[model samples]
Target: MVVLVLTACPAGLRGHLTRWLLEVSPGVFVGQISARVRDLMWARVLELSKDGRAIMVFHADTEQGLAFRVHRHDWQVVDVDGLSLMLRPHEVGGQSELRPGWSSVARARRARRRK
Candidate 1:
């Protein structure tokens, strides 16, 4: 299974992706295709996503059941000890500066304690 999600992309790119995958939602596409085809589609997506964000997730043989990649996005999917996790982008100085929300600060504090 392969899934690709696009945000703030152009219409032409979205149409092109629709040809290869089903448009389950406005910008969400899902399909099962060969790796070669998927890679080809991703190439197009990268070329056309300008200023937009694209995320692709697929079934893989990795330690985690699924593998995911992001392009031009503020969030990222990371593989840690066979578990897929999401990490938000932070400022260069420190993450605390970017996460000003009380909940995020608390969560960060807890994460620090765990470390």
Candidate 2:
């Protein structure tokens, strides 16, 4: 089974994918197909999704039992200790940092760092 999530893509691209996959939701597609076909579909997306982002998740014989790949996305997919995590893009000017938590101590530390 393959699941594909697309953002900001052209309608034509979505139409192409709908041929092989079901458009379960807007910009979301899912279906069961061979790996080769999946690759071809992604390649077509790459060619057509000029200003879009896409992510493909499929079953694989990996430690996590599944694997995912992202394309043209702002958020980054990172692998750490056999786990997959998503990291959002850092804010401009680095205003607020994602620290341990919003404890009083954490707030105080941020204030101290500014000084």
Candidate 3:
């Protein structure tokens, strides 16, 4: 088994890429999909890119089953034979700062430091 980490700068694109890969390869791959998907995911991502969307994909190899963590959330088990896992922003800790009032706390901390 292998672990792959995929990330997209923009949140919307991430979901779009993820869905596209799933549609193309089904359970064959897992983890976030982005503009890099084409080169990283190889032919499969290329087929999905025909629709035209910037995507990125990363591949990592693991000896055992792949586990995903995004935004502190554990992803649902996706049974695929290869060594890859797709992760959404929220699933991989990318959305950790998106919580309600997080910005306010950060601002307050910054203000305190400045003082």
Question: Best candidate per lDDT, number?
Answer: 2
Q: Please give each candidate's TM-score.
A: 0.76, 0.79, 0.24
What lDDT would each prediction earn against the true structure?
0.88, 0.88, 0.42
Q: Give stretches of model 2 more than 4 Å off.
A: 93-115
lDDT tens string, model 2, 1-115? 9999999999999999999999999999999999899889889988999999999998888788788889988678898998877878776366655555579998888889989
lDDT of 3: 0.42
For model 3, residues 1-115, the per-residue Cα lDDT tens digits are: 2222333233443455455445334223344545354444444433443433332324334555233323222343344675445533463345563654468887787788889
Candidate 1, after superposition: displacement of residue 83 in Å?
3.3
lDDT for model 1 comes to 0.88
Residue 43, model 2: lDDT of: 90
Flag the better candidate by TM-score, 2 or 3.
2
**What's model 1's TM-score?**
0.76
Candidate 2: the clashing residue pairs are none
A best-first ranking of the candidates according to their lDDT comes to 2, 1, 3
Question: How big is the positional error of residue 19 in model 2, measured in Å on the Cα after superposition?
Answer: 1.0
Candidate order by TM-score, highest to lowest?
2, 1, 3
